[model samples]
Target: MSWMEDLLLLGIGGIAVSVYGVVAGLLLLGIDRKLVARMQARIGPPIRQPFVDVQKLFTKQNIVPEHAVAWLFNGAPVVALVSSLVILLYLPIGSIPPVLSGYGDLILIMYLLTIPALALVAGGFSSGSPYATVGAQREMVTMISYELPLAIVFIAIAWRMSADGIGDPFSLVTIMQYPLWGLVGPLGLIGGLILLFILLLVTPAELSRIPFDTPEAETELAGGLLVEYSGKNLAMFYTAQGVKTLVMASILIALFLPWNPSGLLGLGGILAAGIDIAFFLLKLVVVVFASVTLVRAMVARFRITQVVGMYWLFLGLMGIIALILLGIDAIGGA
Candidate 1:
């Protein structure tokens, strides 16, 4: 494709992914409300409730704290939105992400994922609100806890792919074509399953959902890091949140559902793409439902220390074992 063609596709694909994020995130929130209602045996708001909430937030007046840094306080939400959107641009949504895949190393995606969290921390610190400051601290702590296991999980996958003798292409596009899961060798499958569980655990925390929502613990911090935001500023944060939710889910899919959409494996293009997209979204929803909704219901919020301990002790150990297993399997194959 020509440079202009690539640029156009990138713009269109990026916008499509952003729109999907908005729609899917809102739907997931509504689904959570309904699911919770079902679990609690109570009525729930309409599926449109999240949309209504965002609209109301937008209509609210913007509030700036006298003690807040005016520039950063105003710029925070934009930073979040841009960071999250840039991540979406790097990811493969319904089909693929353009303009980023040539250099779309998994490590690059990892760095992009950190951007929103860093932006949130900066925004919170600049707000000069006690709640915001506390939230920022919690966010940093949570990032420290989860990042190790998440990195291990990605590295394990890449390591496994290299062991398969695919010549070390760590881009999602390359890994997507390999049938690592199809190996299903006892140790490899076991390790992959363990890593998948760890990834699922990290997903909600990364997205700041229920149990790991310490950064925005509303009951305790009165909206936590966002306590001081209002109007358009709040709207940007809200939208970035929606985008981030989709980004996390998409990453899960890309890592786990690496099936081909172009039907290279004896399947026709249209049929293969349909199967790929369907299974991809289905896997994503299942992951979201389990991690964000079911886990939230099953577990109570942990103390900060307990949260950190859980990630480092349980999830971290799991990742380490997973990598070891993959290494052993790779050696055996070699």
Candidate 2:
């Protein structure tokens, strides 16, 4: 195919991935709510609750606060949702390659991950609400806090791959091809597990979910960063939240659990792809449950100070130790 034809095909693939991301993200959110409720012994909304909420939200009128910077306030949610969708296009489904493979890598995705959060901060500050302003500040701080350990997790894995002579160590496709577990020996395996745990801890913060959800502490900030958003604008942010959750889980799968049962069972063709995709979704569910739902259910919101310490101090130290172990493992192997 010519370049124009290839571009058109990619556009079609991008659309398909966007739709899948939104639907799957919302579904995962609904499941999370239901699971959390069950843990608390209370009945929860159905698995379609997020979908219903989005539908209702779009029908309601969008109210831009009179004092708000109308353009920035109105634009933030669109940016957030669109950026979240773009991140999904670069992440592969089970047996499928990413829609825009070779054009992007994990580092680009890491940077892309921040755009939605920055958009939220911009939206909140533009709203001109004290609560939102505070929320935006907290969101900015949270992003800063998580960066060290998050980068450590990425660099450790990619470096290990590089030591193993894996080409394109920064590529998600390469990570999937030689999962860290298979490449690592005993100490590296422990280090890899530690990195996975650290990433799981970061997932909640990345999505602004509980414990780390200081930015949207509804109790204290009265919806916090989103205090002034309503109707369609709110819906887009809500959907973006779900998509970000899905994106985080998908990244975790690519890193830690990229195995396919089909290959082990000698399956082929459509059957292999079907089974692999099914297995991948199952991993997403597990990752989401462990990282987001379970953690949120078990913990109260952390103070902003505590949030910083947890990520930068505690997780950061752990991440450093993990990197050291991986280094030792590399030397020992050599």
The numbered model that scores best in TM-score is: 2
**CA shift at 316, candidate 1, in angstroms?**
1.2
Q: By summed lDDT, which 10 consecutive residues of candidate 1 come out lowest?
A: 90-99
Predicted candidate 2 versus true structure: per-residue lDDT over 1-334, tens digit per residue: 6999999999999999999999999999999999999999999999999999999999999999988999999999999999999999889899888999999998999999999999999999999999999999999999999988989999999999999888999999999899998877899989988999999999999999999999999899998999999999999999999999999999999988888898799999999999988888888899999999999999899999999999988999999999999999998987
In model 2, the Cα lDDT at residue 26 comes to 97
- lDDT per residue (tens digit) for residues 273-326 in model 1: 677666667766776777787887777777778789999999999899988887
Candidate 2 pairs with clashing backbones = none
Clash pairs, model 1 backbone: none
RMSD of 2: 0.8
Clash count for each candidate, listed in order shown: 0, 0
Best by lDDT: 2
Off by over 4 Å in 2: none
